[model samples]
Target chain A: MSHSYEHPRPALAVDCVVFGLDENGLQVLLVERGVAPFKGRTALPGGFVRLDETLEEAARRELEEETGLGAKVFLEQLYTFGDLHRDPRERVVSVAYYALVKLSDHRVRAATDASAAAWFRLGDKPQLPFDHEQILRVAKARLQAKVRYQPLGFELLPPRFTLAQLQSLYEAVLEKPVDKRNFRKKILSMELLEETGEREEGVSHRAARLYRFDRKRYVALEKAGVNFEL
Target chain B: MSHSYEHPRPALAVDCVVFGLDENGLQVLLVERGVAPFKGRTALPGGFVRLDETLEEAARRELEEETGLGAKVFLEQLYTFGDLHRDPRERVVSVAYYALVKLSDHRVRAATDASAAAWFRLGDKPQLPFDHEQILRVAKARLQAKVRYQPLGFELLPPRFTLAQLQSLYEAVLEKPVDKRNFRKKILSMELLEETGEREEGVSHRAARLYRFDRKRYVALEKAGVNFEL
Candidate 1:
């Protein structure tokens, strides 16, 4: 038996830009490709989409298969790249996605089709294969703009974090120094964070009080048309 | 000659959600389909992708072919839809794009493959075919969110427009009433609009002053880290 369609078809694939934050600053995950066409070259973790799954599922599966990362994170569809010569093998269309994960939670480990996996600081990073570099740049721009209007930046922080840690996350993503007093006053007025009734466990200086993001309150406030700006 | 590959591929297509603004309010361009799958049903102007053209080119071509609208407009890729059951005949993946045009500039007329073409109020649209309703909803949400931060609403208005016209564009897209004095004060403070030194013509009442969007100034201000928030 055979199936026939006259026109040529472009192969579809999914690529992910996974971002994580730590004391060092914002970072992106890259995997060393273990197969041709760009074998041994560092690139985003992704692969051709299977016949049975949605684009989001394909992104999640590819991220875990190449980098040993978990599927639980803040994931979003960023953009689709369909440049004629983007892939060397054939005409391929890639649906790109961006994911945010807490650095302290997911340890980096290479697996399956990746020779090595590691996090690279946003500014200082290895040369990428194909169009992964462009995709990463787009994701960074989106993160920078979105962080100013949405609360997704909290996804990069720990469950219990100090106000200083939260402010640092914003600074790292936005690449700008926010006024300490103004930042504190604005975020606190939104009332999206709750006192965790605890302090930083281990630090060289006096520990500061920790707080947790109030997801329920945030959802209610968002429904009531509250704009979250920092 | 024939090419052989063993894997199944989804048929690729492009759909456009073309938005225009007028005295009636925000409107979308819809065409009465002349072919099947949904024969005679009203849907967005679009068609399958050709092997030679890029996704954007395909979108522009389809828009012009289905409706007699010109190819000059502000076009942007919205999202990709690939539900397995979206097309009854076969698996299809659609790359959706949204375009903004001035209603007065483009007098729409049905052409080659459409039975009829017309602009319908966004809220009072006819029943659409093949998941197009969902695509339009996404486009509307994107437009509403984007209008608050960007100067895209100008694309919907005439080149020289009055402050009242600009405010109405925002109100129609946002589906909410904006305070007249506040809207003018905020928009004027940005200094992105330049006075044209002319007034609207052929009106029974006093003519209002007209202004032009300063694209060059907006670009410079954006590069200098100016935020265009309303």
Candidate 2:
């Protein structure tokens, strides 16, 4: 086959840029490399891509193996970085992905092989290896852009979330304080959220109605040019 | 070096999803593949990545070799596809890029290798090789989305353009008619376009003032979160 006959292929790798929203702000997941080149340095949770697995499969596998994240989490390809010298040793092509998981489900158990895996406040993250710092910047920009058009903020919220939490999610991602009345009007007019008869118990103030993202309705309305803005 | 290990690597390929806007509406650049596996089939302009250069360079080289396009056009990484059976012959991973070029500048010329190269109306493109059709669809969707928030619509037009031409560019890519008054108000409010004291000639009606995209002002405003919505 021409694919195999022409020349040698470059090494392939996968990197994940995981994001979660917390009380302080957005946090990103990073793992300390246990092996060579950048050993002992913090980086996105990722590793080599296997021969048989596709990039998505490799990302999911690495996410699970390194950070104990599972298939149920939301993940999407952000971009690919294939600069020849991105990896000092050889021509390594890294396909980067961005994942959004709820901070409330904060049960991340680092794998044994990795020296350390932890969530760092995005603003306080250590210097990452290779082009990972650039990759994280792209991921944050993507999140900011997506939160306006797509109803992806639900990925970082509990199954039954209150209105205040949803507003906080949008505020955190956009990095700006939004008028509460306008935010509520804009989101509710889209009709992509279902109001459930539930409320939070621990807060001192009167709780708001719990809501869940109506994926089906969102998909249907999205096709008809519905604007899910905040 | 771990990168030097004799591990299996997937063949890297590049695919170009080029967009053009003309009087006939939005069009996409495509070529007829001359080589085997899918000979004589229409496909996106692309080729294999050389070991010496980066993937961006490889993409530019492939685009030039196949379609006679130059390196000055606007190019952005679209996405990466790494499905195992995406290529019929071997494990091939393709990095797709979307390019926007003014239709009046570069004349479409098919090189010796490609059987034919032409621009097809975006909505009337033929079934493409591999997963390129899906890639093209995603590219068009992205273009439509970006033209609203970013100054990308100008890339499809000549350096000097009128308000009507700019509105038409949006209408073409979006596949819908936009209110001229509303579009004009929204775009003018952004203050990213500078009047050039020129007008279109040979027109039966009143010629409109010519304008150019102000890159410096755009950069400043973009950093300020002032979205150029229209």
Candidate 3:
């Protein structure tokens, strides 16, 4: 059976907002466009969807192709942007996705369809082309909102980290100073982190205990629909 | 400048899951397909996207054209499903949306592209065609999870409702018996509802006082990023 339409269909595409964390704060991955309508301007890594791939697959493929990021990073669908004038050359409906990666684990390099790839501090990102600025804003808000009730911040941290590192991550994402005593009390009360019985390797001051997120317990709590308010 | 692709582009579409509540419980609006690719089978009200409208506009248009639903419903984009074989005829990508409406406010009638439209209790719905079943399941889960932290349940009830109605709404959506004392204590603590200075009328039993949702306060709290965890 063949399907044809009397009207022109909008082009389906996928874009990714990749967020990474470092000592400074949260960062976003952007690539210099290799083709027009926004040629030479920096944009999120993305491309048109292909017939053989799912939306997430297309996002991952474009991520790897444009920014040299691997497919194993945590990714989730953010939203679908379909403004009438989003693309000047055509009617393009983009399914946007957000990804979290460990900044220390993978260093990005431009490749394939992109001229250059780099991480920019959240507030210091260059003016984006098309509707990418709005997409990135939405992704940032989703990350901030989700971090309050979900254990998504762990994806941007190392496998084992100190309580101070966790607090720093939360402060960076939430953009506020957390009460040290209350933060520690609430986080420890959740019982979702287990002491690794190891100390920070080389600290100028008294080293804190290293802890690893208990993924199994988190998954069970999530499955049981337990609210994680932090 | 015009754009053309060397390969066939996947067709874009929009589908909406309309949720309503009644004395029986939560209900969903479904329409019987009037065209092929399901023909007479029931499915979510939807159609292909048009170039002139946005994805949400397309969803609202389809809902009205197929199910007699108006444009003022509280609708949100749920997710985009881009499975390769979701549509049997060709490669189709659909952006799914979920809408909430008061059952007492509107009477749905089948029109335009659908053969018939009707409401079915969530658990009593027939086996839907295509991947609509999965979309509906996701919408249900989203509603259930969100009601715990958001004031979305109020959208399904009448303008002036009793605290008992609000509790029933939560109990219905969460599919469990919520403790009365705890539910009242927590809900009142949020300070999101105000007395309407009216009592329920025309009831055989005791007429309880009516309350209305505090939309202004809710909007303010939402802007301030307050967590309404219940």
> Which structure among the candidates has the greatest lDDT?
3
lDDT of 1 at A151: 97
Candidate 1 CAPRI level: acceptable
Residue A44's lDDT within candidate 3 is 91
| Candidate ranking (TM-score, best to worst) | 1, 3, 2
How many angstroms is residue B184 displaced in model 3 relative to the true structure, after the best TM-score fit? 4.0
Better TM-score candidate (1, 3) = 1
Can you write out model 1's per-residue Cα lDDT over B123-195, one digit (the tens) per residue?
A: 7988888999999999999999899989999999989999999999999999899999999999999999999
| Candidate rank order under lDDT | 3, 1, 2
Residues A36-115, model 2: lDDT tens digits: 78988999988888869999999999988888887989999999998888888878899999999987775346423344
Clashes of 3: 0
Stretches of candidate 1 exceeding 4 Å from the true structure: A1-4, A108-115, B1-3, B108-115
Alpha-carbon lDDT of model 3 = 0.89
Could you tell me the lDDT of residue A190 within candidate 3? 84
The Cα RMSD of model 3 versus the native structure comes to 3.2
A-chain TM-score, model 3: 0.93
Q: How large is the i-RMS for each model, in angstroms?
A: 2.7, 6.6, 5.6
Better of 1 and 3 by lDDT: 3
lDDT of 3 by residue, B69-129 (tens): 8898899999999999999988899999999988877643532324488888988989999
